[model samples]
Target: MSDAHTADEGRAPRRVLVVMAHPDDVDYGAAGTVARWTAAGHDVRYCVVTDGDAGAEDPETDRAALAATRRGEQRDAAAVVGVKDVTFLGYPDGRVETGLALRRDVARVIRRCRPDLVLTHSPDRDLVHVKASHPDHRAVGSAVLDAVYPDARNPCAFPELLHQDGLAAWTVPEVWVRGGPVTNHHVDVTDTFHLKMTAIRAHVSQGGQSAEFEETMRARLAALARDAGLPDGRLCEAYLRIDTR
Candidate 1:
């Protein structure tokens, strides 16, 4: 869809939720697009499935410390994208599951956020490379999709959330999955690319030559934009739209 259509459509989402498996996943995949959404006056919330405890070195580093550090970094990243609320499910780094429990947690967030749209990883995240795809990504995506469907929208499911937490039933109208083969939507993020890069640079504990990774990340995003037929010199983020009609 074109930028003009996104701006003109009356149905454009006012509240958006982005669910991802790791702290930096959204920054790498969709932070620029999120900046666009927030700039358009939409409320954006970020939900990270894992604490990223396994992402750091220094064997003596406690899991709680790592989690705390990551959470702060995530919040900083969200701020860069103009998102004010950020949540973490506290699931383990590599062991997210697609079961009733995870679904319930995700459903609770969906209901509480009352987002008109949700964005998440592709269920088939291993399509590019088996070893490259993190298992947590697929698991979180599947659980989020289930939550957005009959679980979150249905008042009957996860009754505890409604009774105990005061979260109401909510049905998000659209879901956009990133890292899919059939990318049908592109968001012009030329104005937000630098913000995205800044967010990514905040994850300094995950040791690497910062200069190298940043350059590589910029090149990759540029290539992705080009592959999606975005105009030259315009950075973009791509996604596959799924209507929850």
Candidate 2:
């Protein structure tokens, strides 16, 4: 895992595809890195697998309204980081599965984007991150991994994609999975921490107790950076890097 993405100086993936289960999923761990990537001229696109209709915990929360709100919030969040392309698969939130349908959808985006790198959720469900390892997250991760491999790379895997959509096969070189038991890569995001917070703020429905959440989030970021071996006061995002090639 460590060998897959050692970040050779000045070498960056030309195009990056980020796949996640819900609207704010990517913002939780990788928003800062996304900002940094876009700042460096790397093209990053987001593929959100679900509408996140089931995100609100309150029984009175209007699911449909919440879904629409989340989608708009996500678009705003993406724009904050300079990302213009965001694809919402429109799958039912909290019920996504690693089925052929999910694979096909992910494969379509991968082929269309032709990204050299893909970032997604970790496949494993560690005890430390039971919430992050939600079933929907795991399902999306498994499907994304499969789609990045044979489904997106093999021309014959989904013939309809070629005959109907005109998408060609695409082979992605590397995938970096966020939030797992083992972290092999750390993206220094000190300079882009503020941008990350701004992006996170776009999800107005997700935050709580403004002052408390902001303070807690800052502390969490600091702890994450320290645990990931970053220099003092530097912000970092950890990932389990995998070589798809």
Candidate 3:
């Protein structure tokens, strides 16, 4: 991971696409890193697989309205991290499945974006922290990985994309999996941590309005920085970097 980071440290800005399950997933996992990239002049886009309609605990909540609200919230959140492009796939929040449909849809975005790097959740479950391994997250991860490989790059995998939408095959060079059990890459995000919090705070409907949530996130990031051997007071975001090239 360090070698990879060093290799690309001072390279020209590359396009980055973040694919996530819900509105706030990016803010929770990669907002700080995203801030750094944007500040460095990288192009960034977001493809949210779901609208997070099932996020609320209230049984009587209007799912459709909630979904709309979440989409708006996600757009606002992305703005905080200097990302202006956001695409919502409108998949059911909690019922996302790793299927051909999802793979193809994600592939479409890949071709459209032609991103050099794709950031997503971990397909593998984390038994240590079950709460973080949401089923939808894993599903999106698996689908996106598949899309980045055979589906998006292979011309025959999704022929309709080329024939109908004129989206050509795109091969993503690398992928960074967030919230995975194993992490080999660490981004020193101390400078952008506040932006991360501000992005998360945009998801007010999902408890991001709470000051306690911000403090908790701060503590967690600090702990991660320590684990990554960073000096005290620094903050970081960790990822399992996979080379797809």
Candidate 2 colliding pairs: none
Q: Measured by TM-score, how close is model 3 to the native structure?
A: 0.96
Candidate 2, residue 45: Cα displacement in angstroms equals 0.5
**TM-scores for every candidate against the unseen true structure:** 0.90, 0.93, 0.96
- Between the candidate structures 2 and 3, which one is better when assessed by TM-score? 3
* Candidate 1, backbone clash total: 0
lDDT of every model, 2 decimals: 0.81, 0.86, 0.90
lDDT accuracy of residue 111 in candidate 3: 98
Candidate 2 segments exceeding 4 Å error: 1-9
In the range 16-106, model 2's lDDT, one tens digit per residue, is 9999999999887798888878877889999999999888879899999999999999999999998999999999997888999999999
lDDT string for model 3 (61-153, tens) is 999999999999999999998999999999998999999999999999999999999999999999997876999999999999999988999
Which residue runs does candidate 3 get wrong by more than 4 Å? Answer: 1-9
Ranking by lDDT: 3, 2, 1
Q: After the best TM-score superposition of candidate 1, give how far the Cα of residue 23 lies from its true spot, in angstroms.
A: 1.2
TM accuracy, model 1: 0.90
Position 53, candidate 2: lDDT: 88
